[model samples]
Target chain A: MMRRKLKVAVFKFASCSGCQLQILNMEDELLTLTDAVEFTYFLEASRATAPGPYDVTFIEGSISTPEQEELVRRVREESRILVAMGACATAGGIQALRNWLRLDDVKRAVYPNPEWVKALEHSKPVAEVVKVDYELRGCPVSKERLLSFIKQVLVGRKPYLRREALCMDCRRKGNVCVMVAKGIPCLGPVVQEGCGAICPTFGRGCYGCFGPSIDARPEALASRLREIGMKDRDVARLFKGFTGWSEKFRKVIDELEGGAR
Target chain B: MVSGGIYSGKFGELRKLFNALRLRGYRVIAPKLEDSVIRLKEVTSFDEVPYGWEDIQAPGKYSVREGGKHFRHGPDAPKRILYPPRLELFRLRPDWSVEYPKERFPPTALFAIKPCDLASISVMDRVQGGIGDPYYLALRKKLIIIVENCVEPGATCFCSTMGTGPEARDGFDIAYTRLDDDLVVFRPGSDLGVELLSELNIEPATDEVLRKYYDALKNASLKAKAPFELERLPDELELGLNSPVFKEVAERCFGCAGCNMVCPTCFCFDVIDEPELDGGAVRVRVWDGCFSYTYAEVAGGNFRKDLWARYRHWVLHKFAYWVRQFGVFGCVGCGRCITWCPAGIDLRETIKSVVEWVRSRGGS
Candidate 1:
């Protein structure tokens, strides 16, 4: 039952670094976490760095720039298990909304000299660029799930993640079905069950912060929205949120917006 | 509160049963109005029950109004408390040894449960007959069921059609029909129920009171609609696989699994393994539904990838497959799925549409 200390690293790309901050927020398990896995290349937590060839590397955020794409490729090559954390690293996050627009137009509008822009034309999740062994999908990444994943990896077991719709957790919490009771158009049916069905419990519709579930039915949900008086454009805009770049949601957005809004 | 225990007070006093059960170390789970929904929750006092509140339900709409006559079934059913949405199965050691949880639950009494819900439990029992769920069995052994006849059924109620409700004939310890005069006529179905009734200084229900209760029950049974042509449903669903109604229903469905979660019979679940920091893993079974996309998924591919297929699977299974599997109808005609559907997709309407579609092709 003797276990060797595993080397762990947390890297960031084109994100707000909120997912990395979630790691620090795990204060209760911080000591136990460090004891299990030796921190190797996390710049956010410590200045001291360990060399490459790490056992597990967690990449948080999307690759928006050519430099970031190349760095993610190198990180993938160096790490044994590259786990994508957060919506950005898993489903392109909110930054992927920029993928819908022309990159040249965006560059010209933001910068006077468009020629100076060295970023990739599209902001993409880490999985789109490199092979991800596992994904912890969420807007900022669930700290509890991250801790569980790390422990499972350390024990040579599979991490448990609920891939059901948000409604499952919402019902388990005994929250009155908001969509049914209040007539609110909720994305809970198509959204992944993480974040503990937070938004719906708080009396707000899910904005797909955890991204779409494995077999989400955005088109079907969109039809419900339309039946409930939401315009096609509005439904499209709803899907154009955090996980807009995900295939299922992207297809829904395209159909609702007729490929261009 | 009376001198001679529960029966001494008066005929139709529900407080007696409530008090007797509580005194016997049973936690009474009753319908309590919370957050604008009548939920099946634990109640400590009789005042906690929404006595006068009447629920008005329609497709995609539900509301409560004061001065209503009879109690209507709410979104919360007995399944929520009994089966539960999430249950811990076992734990795994670093050596991969399985360790099942030995936690004991409190003695529970489901108060005022409707006939349809009670019938659903029968169906569930049949489904779990061969290899009974240890967790469910443990909780069930310490459970008491008090069934309530629906003297005034809700608008969406179709239990009469299913021959499962308006009155509970079996699978319950005690059954009661609340009269208009506030007198509740009690009927004992078990030895324990008769023993409890004998302890109470209760008088036999008078002929007049019995007559009134029967009339009300009769009226409710008459109002009940059996929309499903059950004999034709199996053949209809089998032939109507390509029916456009499936697509129409799927269009409005969010695949939220709300219907499945609220259903008294659905027992599907997904197992989750949470590894502890100490190299131990806690395996838990969380509720899952066929409506969920991942429910039919495997490493190779998803079986019910399309929403239409998933919706069809849910409908056919409830109507056809369950009959073949458990020798009982999966649906007790409780109508929770209709009232709780965010899209207002009515199962009665859906079944009727399928029947009509089958008939339109000149087939019985």
Candidate 2:
């Protein structure tokens, strides 16, 4: 007997929608993916909205509003598996940059009518509000990894990720060490392995787009940067990019500042 | 102690031995002079050897010249075998499905490997083959190494500090030391080496002959320069990390990944699925670098946006983080990164800067 196709839905909240665009960018694999799973709701690709009981739900963006907070909770209730797609859904994305500053200042800077703007002070990942079964990391998740995750989930298999540092990928690509040769500051060691170590290939250092990796000793890395002639402010600024609002990166940055005197 | 074996007639006799081994189905690879570099190339005869030649190497320059019949190796002479700039790790189909290409792993006999090059291979083996990489293990399993003691260490070499030298130590299957009058001293380091020597039908050496070989090798090791003080590295690095030295060095950085590419120990990689027009795709692992801006960036944005953070990450990983995780220092003191860096960013100077900065900051 043929079983019913798995109902999948892709949801977005407050974001640039780049993660969804990355999904659409998987042009070659999209047709095959569509044939394999039932995409019941993907508003970025379709205007049609479906209600309730999704087999799998991929959530992008972060919770920046009270409505989104409630909506995420209801979505979690209806979905059997909730997967956070991209850094926004997994680590609060760049919008979380506001997490470091004062709330009133941000409200005044962005909204003409602060009283009408019903917004949360800080941007937050889906996991802050609801449970997440899986997380596809990166500012925009790697297409290879995204497809692999989808296929693995469909087949009920574990998708294995080589969670080494970006340095490993850098070394494998045969790129000269930008730090050693060019003295460029890089984040290949503490950053997670993904995106095929692209920046280093084109003569640039890693920018930590994948967020803080497992056991990413950023404090030690920052200290090393200082030895190599980097300023404390530069180090602080480095951790403040992309995943700056993440607890791990924030703590590392705070620690670099000597624990706020 | 010096060791001696009977004169195996002409140097051509060694070629015959290689050919005989090949006839017996052993894949023979030897150092051949190609485009002024002593590259490991497959050869069937003695004529293919880099005869009557030697190499000169320094920062940003490499040249091999004829007329020096003495088997001298240049430290800067591009160690292509130990550090292949590019290797087809695996081929992929258009689709993401992967197929392990059937590699011809014949019983390989690597001839005329210099001591420094030999030591580099051992270091790489400890990282790639020793750490549960069945792939590297397979390649290593079929390899037979022949270490040739360098007559003169290259100008850029500092193998002595890393405890590698112009003389062979333990890892080789066979060791050779060049002496006066075209006489080569051979020491069998393994049973296979002994077997190969026996097949040559060379007479055993007297104690006096053996003594000469040791004296030659000992002198070579002594002649080599010492590497940096590796013992003080971890603490020095810790102290250095907070110093103002990085900025000065980073100012000269052009963000080129040449240093990592030339290094034998740098083994980071990235995996990608190459989708085919067909329903299948091949997943291939390729070399990657940390210096690139996108190495850590995800879909939304980058994390280590600054050049300072990225550079610090690379050095710290090599010195501090790798030691913490692997229980060993990541660098092998090859100095290739220093010599190959177009900007001439010397690693020794960088370390010195770190040390000075730490001292100024009152760091221990």
Candidate 3:
């Protein structure tokens, strides 16, 4: 008796498609993954689209337009479980920096014909528009993490996401503290563990691509960044990265904008 | 057999010890300077040990330079070898068969270790050894610890305050103090140390050279400081439990748990069940800290929900609770926490805050 193959769908809105690319980067494991699940609707990978009612739907971008908003809500209704993948789906990626600016000015600067483009006033994560069952966060999501998520889902077990800070991974790897040793302002103390603290392992500071962890004290980290000679606006800009629109990081950006920097 | 003999040799003679350890089939874990950071990693060659390079460590600042005559300190500790950050305890298959992983405890020599780290090993021996953890105990038994006494302690060092360093009294099989770039003084602590030193083709120490070595040890002690006396620390921490200083320090703390990660005596761990799609589960253990927000969490809610509460728990556990638990302070006062913390939050300042809180009420 053969078990039914899980029907999976990958959707994108306004992202670089890097997170979706992680599926192809899975090496020989991609073949193993294909055997376990049928890719029902992957627009980037294939032109053929099957109507949803997907077992699992992976949303890869933020809802920056009215069409994406409608699609995400319908995907939520059609899927048993909807997982928002990458920084855009979890916490509106770098595009959310426009949330601080005038929407018309942002559109005019990016597009030659501002009237031709269609976008909402502010880009929002999938959770803001529709309930997201899970999130695999990163600028470009980790191949290992995505595989682990699928593996757990296949086993009918809840996927365990890490709540620890990126610094924990850095410490475990016995990597020298770039922020402490080099005076580089790092967001490892606030960002969640997912990428295995890759930046710090290479003697560089973490750029907070994984968003805030359970123990994130952004105000405390922001103040530390300031004490290390980072200018007010630069500190604000530092927090305004991939996960800037998230609550912990958004609070820092909001406070800085409110003249607390 | 007489133990605790002081011997003298050329600096290059230490290389002979490395050779002998390898010949005995022991992996030598020595300090190797790589990419500017001096790490206590496995080295096949003695030349890998950065002899004359020392690290300048301060609150949130560390760098390596050539002028210093002492061996530099790094973030890597001997604990990683004994009690690793992540380990698979066992695996349970679908057939209900348990597969225990082979012990990774190889015969290893901890070569050229500092005094503060030596003290940590002895402390962990009691902490983990007391509980009779098979892995840690097995790894501990296989170690050939060699200590390098601090002639010039790093900026973050406070081993003297903790009575753990500048000169290692015990815990190491063999100890050495660099007299200069070439000349060296050796002190044997155990029977194996005696055997190793006795076989050495080196001269006996003279009174004049020993005098100079003693002076340097004394000088190293004077350089490291404590905010106040630590004799009444547990009582002081008790009095300052409800004080505002913990909250004040927590304000600056990023809750990264950098201090706990770098601290020599921290031993908390979290157990996780990693179930595979093949119907197998691996019971894994990874390092955990009180400063972590997820610590003390249950099904209903987290016990230490606020960052300040977690921060207070860590400080109190190190100073007060550890005294009650192990009859010794959990913190060895190595100051690795201070040097490694991104926030530059110094425990010296935090300890002083506790003392100030205790003094404000005239309790002292």
Candidate 4:
């Protein structure tokens, strides 16, 4: 008897679709992946949609719309394993930036028909509404890593990954740190590892695309930033970026403000 | 074989060795003085080595100085040479339709490799080789390692904690420890090493010579300061995930990924399709870092938007999560992160604070 292929579905709600693109970007691995799994639903890659009960469902975007909120619940109920594929689905993502702003103002700016526009009060990750078997964090997940995750799942084993900060990779690569050599501020000591330390190589700093790492010490990092001559506003602006709406980051920003007040 | 396994030859013999290797179709690369840095470059002779040079490195300064004697390794030489700033894996076109030729790679030998560098290769092997990285494997396969045991240890040298050293280990094909009287003792590790020894017609090592060589290495290791004790870090980090310490650290983090660039074992990468001016394109992978705000962001939005969360993620991944997943600590105890951090944030101190926090919270 021939073995059955794993029925996989890729879903997106409110996102830049970069994570989905990362999947498409797996040029060499795509052929093998397509052969191994049945792509029953992936709106970006295919217009043909299949309904319900997928073996594995990958949710890429956050639930920002009321319709999406219900859709996520249905997807969660229908899938055997639900994996949050990017920052938007794992965390509130960039839309979480709206968490700090007035929701009415955002609606008015984006919708000429504010009366017709219907959205959730707050944007939230898929896990907030549904159970997620695994969460792959990143603005755009690394294709190499995504492939590894898929392969691991296919092979019936937990994925092996390094959960260290980017600083660890920075040290291993032997790049002269912008923080030390150029006196540039760097989140490397704290940011999660996954991206291959790219920005710094190209003379840029980390923007915290992977979401708050497990066990991050924002208080200590705040004091260090002050020592380097950064002001409270700068600190707040820094937190208010990609995952700016993350509860932990918001709390730190609030603390900085409270201290100043 | 001659006595003491020592080969006493003039500096001219070094050039002759390179010439012979070149004639045999091997590329000889060694440290050469370039832009005041000891950079690895193709060499034809001893004249190309950074002779009579040294460097001084401190908290935020690096400078090259002249040595009084000829053919002596510099004291303050930057270790950055061990890890190249950029290494081409394989170039691809933008369309992902084609890959570059693979014929440019030729078997080569890196002469005068320090024991610290040799140890770094072993660490890299575990990351790149063990992880199914064909690019690193191909580059590593065609190279021969010739190590020079540390005759002089740098102030920042602490390979002892990492179990690396002033002495060579299993990775090297041959090891050389410099001795007084202009002589060098060679220890062969593989058949190639043995053959090289035989070709050079070196003497057998005497008990006294071997004793002296080991004694010097041991002293070098001893002279180095001990790294901060971090036995409780992994557990401490797991419990401190919700602590304010991460927030504090993130406030100062500039989000620069310099640490990743200088690291010896980081293997994360991004694949991009580069289109030539012509129609064809190649898909290639380049190094990437998670410290950037966009590392975890999807097209819709970023997840680790906060610098604090990103910062905390890095530390936890290295010390705690990596161990839980890979059955080995991601860190090799190299002090490059601490020494190279522009903000002067030391990982040792950061981990120690976590340990203290865990103990205070009754979690340790």
Q: Best-fitting candidate, measured by TM-score?
A: 3
Every model's DockQ, to 2 decimals? 0.65, 0.05, 0.68, 0.11
Candidate 1 colliding pairs = B7-B201, B12-B184
* lDDT value for model 1: 0.82
Cα lDDT, model 4, residue A58? 91
| Rank order (by TM-score, best first) | 3, 1, 2, 4
Instruction: Tell the DockQ for candidate 2.
Output: 0.05
Residue range B1-364, candidate 3, lDDT tens digits: 3246677889877888778888889999999998788888999998888976878888888888886788646888788888899988999997769999996778999999888888899889889999998878988998999999988888778888888888999888999988887888988888888888766767767888889889999999998777767888889888888889888888998888888788878998888777665667788888888888776787876788888888888888988898899887787777888888888888888888888888898875
Report the lDDT tens digits of candidate 2 across residue range B268-307.
Answer: 6555554432344455655555655555767765576665
lDDT of each: 0.82, 0.68, 0.86, 0.66
| Model 1 lDDT per residue over B16-92, tens place | 77888899999899888887778889999877777788888888788887777667778887778767788888888
Off by over 4 Å in 2: A1-3, A257-261, B1-100, B104-164, B169-220, B223-364
Q: Which is superior by TM-score, 2 or 3?
A: 3
Interface RMSD of candidate number 3: 1.7
For residues A1-261, could you state the per-residue lDDT of candidate 2 as single tens digits? 134677889899988888888878999888867776778899989998788799899899989999999999999999998998888888888888888777778888999987788888789989999999988888888887887777666655565565546665565454444554456777776777778888877778777778776546576567667877889988887877777666778897777776651
- Per-model TM-score of chain A alone? 0.96, 0.94, 0.96, 0.93
Better of 1 and 2 by DockQ: 1
Off by over 4 Å in 4: A108-116, A168-184, A218-222, A257-261, B1-29, B32-56, B59-110, B114-364
- Alpha-carbon lDDT of model 4: 0.66
Q: What is the lDDT of residue B336 in candidate 2?
A: 65
* Candidate 3 wrong stretches, greater than 4 Å: A258-261, B1-3
After best superposition, candidate 2 residue A136: deviation in angstroms?
A: 1.3
Error of 4 at A25 (Å): 3.2
